[model samples]
Target chain A: MSRLFVAMGLVLLVGASLSIGVADLWAADIDAGLVMAVSRVPRTVAAVLAGAGLALAGVVVQLSVQNRLVEPSLTGTPEAAMLGLLGITLFAPGSALLVKMGVAAAAALVGTTGFFVLATRVPQRDPILLPLVGLIYGGILGAATLWLAWATDLVQYLGTWTSGEFSGVLRGRYEVLWLIAGLAGLLWLVADRITLLSLGESHARSLGLDYRATRLLGLVIVSLVVAAVVVTVGTLPFVGLVVPNIVSRLRGDNLRTNLPFIAGLGGALILAADVLGRVVRYPYEIPAGTVFSVFGAAAFLWLLNAPRRPAHG
Target chain B: MTFETCNLSITRDGVPVLEGIDLSLPPGGITAIIGPNGAGKSTLLHAMAGLLSPHAGAVRLNGRDLSGIQPGERARSLALLTQDQGVTARLTVADLIAFGRWPHHQGRPGHEDRAAVADAIETFDLGPLAARTLDALSGGQRQRAFVAMAYAQTTPWILLDEPLSALDPRYAHDIMRRLHDLSRTGPDARSVVIVVHDLGVTARFADRVIGLKDGKLFGAGETGDLMTSDWLTRLYDTPMEVAEVGGRKIPFAA
Candidate 1:
């Protein structure tokens, strides 16, 4: 099923790349459109990479927390990154993209660390409470970003950064997303330890696995991926939450086996969503994040309502 | 190899649960820890398995202090099946059993790990259910699958805490019988320690019995020596009698 989606995504991406050049729809020349599409290959690739990265980050967060509701956005990492981007734009106007990305990454790391500390401090009476705490944390950070954006009269800039669009993800602007691939590779290498830790702390310790170290490593990977994706393409909602749950349904919960499949499906899902956003509005384009929000929310509801299987490990 | 606890005490949240627990078990047979509710049987088992830390004294494996050893090394030496073990995701029977070899191979599983997994599947009669997901199995089957995972760990010492809780009589007997057979026939042999409520089954299947009353050791000896009416009465604080039926000891009371 994911393979079918990938093929469809590729076709849509190619079509959108061609449509970017043909100013007049009726008088479109096939050869000119092909040339334009070929030239924009790099940008399209960047978008795909960013989508895949964010999706993979989502997978890692969901698995680590053992809750489908968790994503980097839900945990306040993206909101924190947005605040950092806002800070850089306001204080150090005309800063390099690298500087902006660094600030965002640092903010994301601190936000993630804060989330973990809060989560650990709360007694484990109900698993559902962790994600609720995360949602509240993310909301607070988002409100802070909103206040900063309004104060600086850069609310438009913040809107573009948070809207989940691909129009600005061209050439040099999108290169930062490649870092997510590196994070994905790191996750694969530590997949075994991560899966063991998911069985709960006591069980992991009983197996002689270093639970705390493994959990910290997973959090770091999640932070890096979340920051990179946010800085590249803004905040894409529900892609991470939806893709991992779908992958786990088709594949088993073994992280080693599911990581690649999750990455592929995540990339494919995001690309397809991006393409649909372009066509749904015809000459104008809706942001992929908006499209994903509508679909991702429905998928989330389905997962929540689905009959829970006894083997929920 | 034997496990010994010397003056062991455990406190949770500054409340003492087990105090001055001194006990030893010789290698190679089934040992049952029989106790009334709240006698700290489960706490003792958890401490022995290194899942809980003792506030004072120590638990030793083959005379080496258990706390001094690393968790991985201890895991290789002992396998524990805690009461109410849970798996919160959809995992196949085979996948669940493969977790047993996590300590042996870490992340990279080899042929030996695969063989051990297969051996566990066959040993627990899970061959037919190997491909089935745990959500699809009956409670009895799921219980057996978990036991198989512990079996695949292949440690010399196996500790179970209330393994038969909520299990029907037939499934309970079946599990006990399997444990009994494994203790007797395994190549390296194994010492099985179980916390059980059914005194009749304990008297019939256990080679040795340790009885606890109100967080203290009431008796510890061979099953025959420990199954007297007076011992049973005092231990449970109820009128109790022991009778032989079909050449098997049965414990009963009003």
Candidate 2:
């Protein structure tokens, strides 16, 4: 039932995304197929891919740390990726796109690992403290990244990539987003292991899981996902954090059962946001990141204040 | 077959928790490890289950060195349930129990794995609540679900740390009764070792007792010998008494 609704909604969102762009496909002067192939399709695909990637990344990080509030955006991942991109742009301005993404991913891994170290030190009595710590950590890294960009006179380049809009995505340019599809597939294979991670270290180890190795694997996947999203479409805040929480609340946290819904809802929600951004101002557009930020902040607050069901109930 | 620890000592950050403890447990009975708070009962149980490496000596399962076995193989040999199991609010009874079979199937559970899960569910009488999430259940129900998960592993030995710490008498007795039956029934009965806090429940259900005091082994013998008023009083460093009613010895503070 819910799956059917989600699928139908996805189809409708895709159609709206394809038709609502500035180029009126119905006009006789326009080559509808070419425009659809080159721009609209890539933009829609990028939105779905980035959204799904972020959501999956969020699930892994949440399970790995055994905390629901933290996500890649909170963990300095995007800031670190931006720093790597900045460094690469300064040293080898003409580096290939793949090389840039590789450097960004490596840097993201280091930044996320640093956050995990800090996370262990922070007392976990209050559920909200971890994300607060992560937020402050990410902010500091973001400040450093901004300072570097300003010093290097590449603030404009940083601004353009980091805003997370799909306006510039085209047929060949957005191909990197397909890596998410492969990563999603990999996640499916390891879905059960990731679920076991939520049992905490002792229980997971008792169940024969290599806790450290599995956590490292999850961290690597999160870093790659964050890097890919940041490299291709800047930062999509709250997609990772918001989508998984809503799905887990409605359903449950069994990753094997909930992975598809999380990925689908994430993709659908972001694509819907993109479509809304396109249609809201007609010929002009808002970045999906900006549009999602408005909705995501509202959702975050609701989730924060929402009364948790009584454990006895 | 017997489980033996030879000169086992565990130190956490250079502070010894269990020091040079040597004991051998005979197979196929409920062996209750009891002591005062921070007496390293849980640490001894963890060391036996291979969670903590001994600083001075070794733990042996039958004849093989416990730490020499691979983690997957060790899980198949024995199952351990810690007191603090962390967050399980999102998992259903069935889902949580099915994780017990992870050692056998890794990620790809087959027909036998499913059968084992079903067996555990039935054994623990959790059929109606199998689909219910952990948060919806009471404390006793959640504890049963975790024990069932450990049971689903189908190992020969099961070790639990404080399985009945916060439970009321009824729930505590209910769990103990089930564990008692599990440790004594059929040809494939499991050897159950538990770090228990309630001396009354331990006396009623445990066939044998291992007493620890100040991180040292104080006594090891049959429950009949170990659960006497004087023995327990000495072990816990407080006055205690035992009364016999209907062929059962019940311990209480004097």
Candidate 3:
């Protein structure tokens, strides 16, 4: 399918999903402007930001690690963010939103760095080994979060983070996710430097690129992106993993050229998932994260079993 | 301009890979660094490119310390190609070659960059495979494209680490010939410092030779003076023979 047409379709779907909700939002009796301003617009914006951020994060992880199978969620960034959020929410319950986000982002940076270090140690690039290690690493972090939550009886608060559901998103609550847009812009600025990352450290250094600095910058961006998404609308599993893969397959790995398409497709996929969640159970919405997982897991399975293409590597 | 190493020493994991290395490599023709495995050949190349910082001493480019030069400036002066040029991303050969211009244009490629890329493709005979992804090509073809990338850098100095290590004699000789021509032809001729394994190619193509063994310089001089069987055997710690062929010398392990 043509990218332009697909893009147009996504924009249309986003528009349609906003106007057509469970409550007849456009009905004459209803305050359509208020409805759009308060609930619909915020939800749509949050979904797009979270999706785009995760997708960009995924590309960064894959590039920095030089492995396509890894993503921010797999690298324990989101789980670590959850732990940070849980701690802040329990201990400093009255903390400002920014404080909470800052704490979460710091934890995320540390966790992602840990994953990056671990990736370097396991030099066997067996394709599957790295991602599996990441999955296990993330699982351990997640278990820690779960155990801590259980001990503190704060497991209920963890609900919003485990699965992304934009139903709760409203005007002032979702503004922090705008930071993802800013971070994405930052990533676009350094896309070429980040692309050098996939070529390996020694090679990048040989090219006059500051290999350590660029890699650190990429990790910082990935951590902040994952933190913003997780703290806001919760963990949107596989959005990063799946969106960037599809975009790279369709386009290529030239980060500068493909950043927009990746952002667009990421936005489209999550918005579509949200729309599907809404319509699949009218008057009762499934979380966008849940909806995406079903599709994402299937796509991942297909990707794994698919006949390997010579041109891919 | 001349590239020189002055008492350079480098260590890896508390053990030295290169120690007290000093040599002057004059710009113009091919210079081959030949040694048995684990002789700090790659380490020396990396340090010259400033990819590795020495534990002590310095590398001077035209009498200026390499450490003092910025990485960006260093890159514009010389382009280094490593032995294992493994790329995970699905990049077309054109994209890969164009990346050589990253230091010059830095993402926003200009007409000159494009022209250099085209010239490199033509020079390396990669026109047929330009659009193809690196994974789609055979090992030799892929290597040719990699060499083209280093050429497209348009730097005055080119440092290649065993680019022809895995190729057949035909492919090896083919690359050597192109590199030989490149170093000799244009006004903006590039000086090449290659970590070469094939002794015959080195004797034929290299104007200067630097022999290394056990993290130290074994010998350094004009190719004629360095290619003797006595120096060659001592360098490798094995018997070697040099035979005259077509009015040129070819050394082989005996």
User: Per-prediction DockQ, in order?
Assistant: 0.37, 0.62, 0.55
Clashes of 1: 6
Candidate 1 vs. true structure, TM-score: 0.88
lDDT of 2 by residue, A25-131 (tens): 99999999999999999999999999899999998898888888888999999999899999999999899888899999999999999999998898767879999
What does candidate 2's lDDT look like per residue over B127-225, in tens digits? 999998887788889899999999999999999999887778888888888889999887889999999988888888898999998889999999997
The reply for model 1, stretches above 4 Å from the true place, is A1-39, A84-103, A113-130, A148-154, A311-313, B212-218, B232-244
Superposition error at A281 for model 1 (Å): 2.0
Quality of model 2 by C-alpha lDDT: 0.89
lDDT of 1 at B116: 92
Which portions of model 3 show Cα errors greater than 4 Å? A307-313
Write candidate 1's Cα lDDT for B1-254 as tens digits: 98999999999899988988889999888999997899999989989998888999899999999999988898889988878665555568898889888888887789999999999999889999998877678888988998898888888998888888778888889999999988888567778999999887799889999998777778899999999998999999899999889988899885
Q: Rank the candidates by TM-score, best first.
A: 2, 3, 1
Clash count, predicted structure 3: 0
**Model 2 residue A111 CA deviation in Å:** 1.2
For candidate 1, the docking band is acceptable
Chain B only, TM-score of each candidate: 0.97, 0.98, 0.98
